[model samples]
Target: MFKNHPKGLAVLFFTEMWERFGFYTMIAIFVYYLQENFKWDQATVTNIYGIFMAGVYFTPILGGWIADNVLGYGKTIIFGAIVMGIGYAIMAIPTDNSYLVFAGLFVIAIGNGMFKANISVLVGNLYGHSEISLKDAGYNIFYMGINVGAFYAPFAAAGIKSFLMNNFGATLAQGYNAGFGIASIGMIFSLIIFTAFRKYYQQADYQSKKEVKVEKDVVLTKQQEKERIIALLTVFGIVIFFWMAFHQNGAALSLFARDYTHQFVGKFTYLLFDVVSLHAILFAIFGLAALLKKSNSSKIKSFGGIFTLAGLSLLIYKISSLPESGKISPEQFQAFNPMFIVLITPIIINYFSKLNKKGKEPSSPAKIGIGMLITAIAYVIMIIASLGLAPVYTLNGSTSAITVSPFYLIGTYFTLTIAELHLSPMGLSFVSKVAPPKMKGLLMGGWFGATATGNYLAGFVGRFYQEWELWQFFLILIVCAALASLMVVFTLKKLKSATS
Candidate 1:
């Protein structure tokens, strides 16, 4: 866990934690902000959300290129952080014009393109050729840091917006920028964390001959490189559908939470939901303890255990004291996926570690294919959940919203989180492992570029929500994910060969 891995992992973990905090905070409330503030319709909001998300992922190609050939990963990450901070600041400004919103999104996208793929490249660079076996585990641990941030961001958004509305008597539209302001502050914290720990990252730098051997001099046959590249791109092609389905959390899923879910809760039901959250916290604490146990250093193990227990205790104490009679909002539901990630990541890691020991571990491509299939199952759950509910928006016309149990969404998110653990982090590991050393950043960017395509497709699918029944839309996603899974499985032998 914390032992044997590069110390740079801690720096990157905290850096990504704060970055994701800001990103997910903005995401949790973004579409609502657009709709309430600008009086936009659902189709327009979903489309805009899709396009903005696409841009956020799309810029990584250029960012990765700049890092690979120009500035290197470290400087690119720092510059990207600054640019993103500026973007967040722009969004935070209390302005009546919607132009600021789009402008802020544009800037954030540019900065993210620079930051996201390159940092992942840095993470991969942390482990050497001999340590390749640990790469997936390293990514799993790093990924948990991301979820820790995502898990709590919605709470920050909800609390900030609630404070502004209640304390200042501000309208929802008027007060939304306060949430954006909180996001900006998160970015500031990220920059501080990264700067303070910047020196550690140098330990993992391949360019620094004094610290690690440079693999850049290793040569491969052109045919070998070509085969690997084709294999990587094939996996990338299939995962496009996975992201298309997975990202519906922010777009179509957000709309469902707002319009279809039974959000209103009595004290008893609220307590029940709180119990679920408490279970998640307890699981995270135990997971952290298990990870700490793997540390070679006694001090790291003891310190991590105490720190984790204390932090979890504080979280539980805070949650227990929250008033329980109010309705849960759409934004609050955003916590479920990250919460599940925190709870389950260790389990997945341990399972894979066991498989590796037994010499039965699946290749990254197979895992990704399994993930695509699992994602299809998530949509299938959604389809079943929508069985009895009348159309919120039918082709004939809009109708009264039906309040289904929150459990439907909870279940949907649960399966999707599993799919993500199997695909997303593993996808990052695959890119890092398979790509040529000199071209790592560029190919990592390619992985995210595939994600951008999928997200754009998600928005395209979302735009059709108005035209079809709820179950029908879910059916479309299921088909896409299933088909992609089949494509990946079809090419499995080739993928394994190239990766080997």
Candidate 2:
């Protein structure tokens, strides 16, 4: 895979990987932290989580714009990295004040916003003249780097929490704070790596100039510009629902795991690595398969088949492990979605490559539509899962917190991961493909803006999981996503024409 790729790919990949390690490590415990430390209600915590995530995506628009017209990608990324590292370190400072935590989180969100879109734009620039041919594969490989960090973060955070709590005589709440500290350490490491490789970014500089030339050369009519903006806005409106449903992995679904799943393995596995070893194993198998496929197609195919079977078997095993009462820790299940991304991305990329060769590849719009629809289906699964549990608070006088099987949340994640494969990387590739050269950074930010919108609404939806029946909340997601899918499908021909 490295043979044909740009020399700068490794530098960017590792940078992104460590950044994600910090990001996911913080997210893995964010809601729990709020509950344990601040004594906020579930609804309030979810809303905060959603808002934070939204901010993370929203700021990228500004970052991308500045990078394209003013700052340049390298400088913007460096600045963002420093800000994020400082933010994470600040979050580690033990405090009873909610304002301080929120301030730290805000800084992190701003840094993320600046960092996220520009790096992708940089990656697209790396392909230069051969962008169309290489965009999909390049994004897929880049995505694997992201998951490599995401896959490990939870385990690292969980381990740190466990160690601090057990050995240092800290309470569970203090351990949670320690986990955030560990996440900050990951950010520091990311900064070190990025700084170390500053000299190697000449390729990124060369590619950016090419991008500027391409932007300057291409001209659009007033009518075309208007149409493009309109189309982008419409797409943005639809994608918000997709994100609202998909991002539940870090909020509602995670809560479900904490309330209902069984995380214990045998003594041996637990001793060597905490029970989070299961997540590490799943990620490893998937990541290895994806990276190794370049060497042997047959081996790749064999690994793909085995991975599917293994995932299915693991799901079964997790379901079987559930106690008679259905409450489990929510964080344990959060790993599954990233694990799914690691497993499915290579297969999906290869499948599309084959389709492209056959002249049968789906349009980007079609893929987005399929993703929205799949997200709708995932919500439907969650709705069904919610039906099994009674409401903690009822309209009538009587109420109870009923235990439901963990399978519902697991099944939802399973379906949502499929949807993510269809949308996330393709969305990134689409921005690189359709965006005007001068506007690459800005448009990339726009894509993240859409995500920001979705992420903000995700908080609202997560709050619903607290007040409404879980089924009702999920049902709302299903309807929202279904409508979004339909809207995209309706405009497919127009979008295809615009891109062509």
Give lDDT tens digits, candidate 2, residues 337-444.
776677777678779889999989898778889999999888787666666675534523222345455566667777888888788877887777667666778888
Candidate 1 lowest-lDDT run of ten: 208-217
**Candidate 2 error regions (>4 Å):** 198-201, 206-211, 215-226, 262-328, 394-402
Clashes of each: 0, 13
| Per-model lDDT | 0.83, 0.75
Q: What is the TM-score of each candidate against the true structure?
A: 0.91, 0.86
Residue 80 of candidate 2: its Cα lDDT? 90
**Tens digits of lDDT, candidate 1, 1-500:** 56778898988988999999999999999988988887788889889988988998889988888888888788888899999989988988877787877899999999999999988988888887656558898898899999988987888888888888989998896567888888888888998998888888875544322222455223557888898899889988999999999999998888888777787776545543453455545645774775466644676666657656765776667567767665888888788888889888988998999999999988888999999999999999899888877665552333336678778899999999999999999999988878876678788999999999998888888987776888999999999999999998789999988766
- Alpha-carbon shift of residue 243 in model 1 (angstroms): 0.5
**Which numbered prediction scores highest in TM-score against the true structure?**
1
Cα lDDT of model 2 overall?
Answer: 0.75
lDDT of 1 at 258: 77
